[model samples]
Target: MATITKRSEDYSKWYQELVIKAGLAEPSEVRGCMIIKPYGFAIWEKIQAYLDRRFKETGHQNAYFPIFIPKSFFSKEAEHVEGFAKEAAVVTHYRLKNSPDGKGVIVDPEAKLEEEYIVRPTSETIIWNTYRNWIQSYRDLPILINQWANVVRWEMRTRLFLRTSEFLWQEGHTAHETADEALAEARQMLEVYREFAENLLAVPVIAGSKSPSERFAGAIETFTIEGLMQDGKALQMGTSHFLGQNFAKAFDVKFLNRDGKQEYVWATSWGVSTRLIGALIMTHSDDNGLVLPPKIAPLQVVIVPIYKKTEQLEQITEYVQPIIKGLRAKGITVKFDNDNNKTPGWKFNEYELKGVPVRIAVGPRDMKGRSVEIARRDTLEKKTYPVDNVAEIVDNLLVQIQNDIFQRALDYRQKHTYYVDSWEEFKQRIEEGGFVLAHWDGTDETEARIKELTKATIRVLPVEEIKEQGKDLLTGKLSERRVVFARAY
Candidate 1:
């Protein structure tokens, strides 16, 4: 097996190596795209299942939207167009035919499209346009819909899950009757994402609103959950935007109110993408390989039977049957690897590299002692558990492993986070890494200047709305409160 580079030695290389070595993802023939392998996709499926349940619980419905968006639809929302225009992938020709020169197939000039279509970077424009037709009265005012699909942005510098040219994600677009309702929906979804990131993914994140300069384009407010990576950089886990009728007005999506007055519908759009997979990797994976949170690990428990003979293996299998049943009964996914082509030692290393939360090895000696050797991926600790009670012991161990990794990540964030009161301190401390908690002038020019000098941007602001008397580190101008600033993925 290929060795993973130590994170401390080279963080970027370590991430790329872990994604591939751990059987997560690899670059595809299409430049800037990725082929998510089965193991990696299974982790995503877990994320989808968890989030989908939460979304349904909150009264949202799953729907499908076209991947090809009419190019003209983007022109309706000016800010939206300005934000994503450069990255939009346009389709001009529909048909390809054999070249007269006999060079391979080529685009036929006669097949030029009447109007161009853009591979959707986002679904707001198309969905809003569709809503205009579906919504006509107060009863149809709130349209909460989400779609799970792949989108293209034509990125120049792509990194697997982080910023690929094409990626899979679920985008929620909702239309509401009032601003308050839209705002509440946006905040609600933000909390949903926060809960999933912290509880399901075992990733600790700070929930806050983005500054004007950092807010999603066309959104009056953009709420986000920012996670601190092991490299002291920030990763935006998810975002919920209160669009404030901008899209509705752009698309002429107006509905009659209770008072019988026509008004544009308030809008909110939120999403969590596969980039979250990148956040997961950076948060817990180590030099040995990935250290997946128990909840998200595809194969939470893997059992390898160690024996030199078929008879010994049969005994081990007999002993393993009930154990697997018990674990499955407890709702844990378990894999029994008794392939003869590979040795037990090889299977052990393989499972470790793949980040299985727990592993149990049953051998002749173990069977004689009525015990099974258990190991944890998080701490790499091994202990022998009574065979009869192994399932109960493992059930508890899985929760502990999840909590342990989250606590470890939280500790790392606290250790690396810094507070600065001056420009010199800001520059010096930022270079050292982690979230830089500092005051900003709360102006776009100041924010832009800070980013120009130091690559860090404001990751998030405290939701508690703390207002402290201070001066901006860069301008020495009047300021209130502090925001997290970090160079991000």
Candidate 2:
């Protein structure tokens, strides 16, 4: 197996190596695209399963929108088009035919399209256009729907899950009768993402509203959850946007209100993408390999038998049968590896590199003693437990590991987070890394100037903020409260 680079030596290289070595993902033939390996995709499956159940619990239904959107539909929403114009991938040709020069197949001049279609960078426009046909009255006002799909954004630079040209995500677009209803839906979905990020992914995040300049295109408000990675950089985990009537007005989607007046539907959109996989790795994985939270880990437990001869291996396997059955009864995923080709030591290192939350080793001596040795990936702590209660003990240990992993990350964030009041301190702190909470003049020019000087944009404005009077670090202008500033992934 290839060795992973130490994070201290090169955090970026370490990340790339870990992603590959851990069997997560690899670059594809296409530029700025990646192929998510089975192991990596399994992690994403867990994320989707949990969030999907949560979304349905809140009255959202799964629906799919077209991948190809009409070109004219984009021109309807000015801000939305401006935001994604550069990344948009347009399909101008419909078919390919044999070239006259005999160089392989090429786009046939006769196959040119009437009006180009864009590979969707986002579904707000196309979804709203469809909503116009379905919505005609207050009864159809709130269309609560979510779609699991892949999107393309022609990126110049990309990192596997972090910023790939093509990526998987679930987007929720809803239409409501009133602004308050749409705002509530947006806030509700943000809370859903917050809980999913913190509880299931075991990733600690700060919930806040994006600054006006940082809000999603055509959105009146954008709420986000940002996580602090081990390298002291921030990753945007997810976002929920209150789009108001921007898309509705752009698409000419109107409905009959209770007062018998024609009004545009209120709008909101939110999504969480595969970049979350990157956040999970950067937040918790170590130099050894990935350290997956128990809840999100694909294979939670792996059993490796330690033995000398084939006879002993058979004996260990026979004894482990009941144990495996017991664990499975409790709904825990486990694997028993008794292959003779690989040595016990190799198996130990392999499972550690794969980040199995727990490993149980059995041998002749342990069988005789009615016990087995167990090691947890989170802390690398091992203990000998009686075979009879091993299943119950492991179930408890998994819970403890999950909570402890989250706590460790939470502590790291608290330690690395800095509060600065002066420009010098701001510059110094920003250079060092982590979230820099500092006062800003809250002007577009001031925000732009700070990015030029420090390369740190406002990550989020704390939803629950502490009201304080201060001056902007850069301008000495009056300010109210502090916002999080970070150079993000």
Candidate 3:
């Protein structure tokens, strides 16, 4: 029943409308927060299940950490504190009491604590502090732990899932005996994120390292998966950081070696958040509505029955039972919409808008011919199929739809990406909006200046490492390789 604004007319408005009209999420009363509806949570659950399995497969264990961190804990690391200080939300008092003027509640003066607590913008400080107590010997060398939690940052401007003050995410913090092991762990997780983004979410990404200016605070190196959206803006899908000995030294986390020598532990941290939902929407969705890949869609197949009489409806259900059972046996999610309140025409549009990968409609004519009407959301194409082997047909169709959508996104990214060598060309290409590969002098000052001039920052330095003779776009100095530059979300 809901219609979305045309994406060609206004991309930002189209996205916001699709998110709400599809029943995914809505703006909450609390500023910079969102209330994820059941449909959206289901999609998130699928994402969690897949990623959690991947984490455990790679030798990571789930763990919990405190939400409230002691304010002084941040001062242990200067860069970490500086990175999040502006956005950190602090709790100054513990209790609330009735206002003396009798309007509402106020902070209880008598219940104030001596120390303030910072709502964790990240768990590194507290987690490392706890690690100091947990690791004391070489036998406890590698600690690979992950936590799924909600974090808050007081963002001045926010969008539903893209830049919320509070959002759900999973962060992996690992400790190793040597710097090599820590670096390898970080790279391994980056691969995990890359595969997850391309195969599961069906969103193609560029796997690379962040520039020094864009690196995670307190990290020696940061690896990231960046995806280009339909609007030509790049979105960082996930990041893995090689933390070196920074946190270990700050929190005094040391383990005794086999030779009885004390040394600081090496560390790594990585995370991906609900911002991925926004990426998914922007990558494959269209003017019709949200277009979901079968691998992660909450509802893969929806069957709508068409009938005029009660007996006709009963006949359709009887025929669909085996097909539904067969589909379910194959681990396919299907919903049978027999609700008489809504007509079949209305149901068809509803599932299309919701981005159900496949839709099947069973009616009297199809029943006479032992066939059904089938529609594929990705292609927006419809066909008639014999009901004899509907389950197998639908199964194969789901797989095809998933791969098709991924290829579509990959093609879009390829079309938008550009390689430019001249300053004038770089400026024009950037304004056109897409990923630009250009030479840089590998200096933070040049990086900062380019962003100031064009508002485009380095998105990543490719893992494959581009080696070529070139000149910087702005300074015209000799450069070793070209880096990816784009305006990002």
State the displacement of the C-alpha of residue 385, model 2, in Å, after optimal TM-score superposition.
Answer: 1.3
Candidate 1 lDDT tens digits, 1-489? 678889889999999998998899999999999999999999999999999999999999999989999999999999999999999899999999999999999999999999999999999999999999999998986888999999999888999899999999999999999999999999999999999998999899999999898889799999999999988889999999999989988999899999999999999999999999999999998888889999999999999999989999999989999999999999999999989899998888888889999999999999999999999999999999899977899999999999999999999999988888988888887887899999988898999999999988998996866589888988899888988899888
| lDDT for model 2 | 0.93
* Per-prediction TM-score: 0.98, 0.99, 0.99
Which regions of candidate 2 fall more than 4 Å away from where they truly are? none
- In order, what is each prediction's RMSD in angstroms? 1.0, 1.0, 0.9
**Across residues 411-480, which tens digit of lDDT does each residue of candidate 2 receive?**
9999989988989998888888999999988898999999999899899898889469989998899999
By descending lDDT, how would the candidates be arranged? 3, 2, 1
Q: Which stretches of candidate 3 lie over 4 Å from their true place?
A: none
Residue 364 in model 2: shift from native, Å? 2.4
Clashing pairs in 3: none
lDDT of 1 at 441: 84
Q: Model 2, poorest ten-residue lDDT window?
A: 458-467
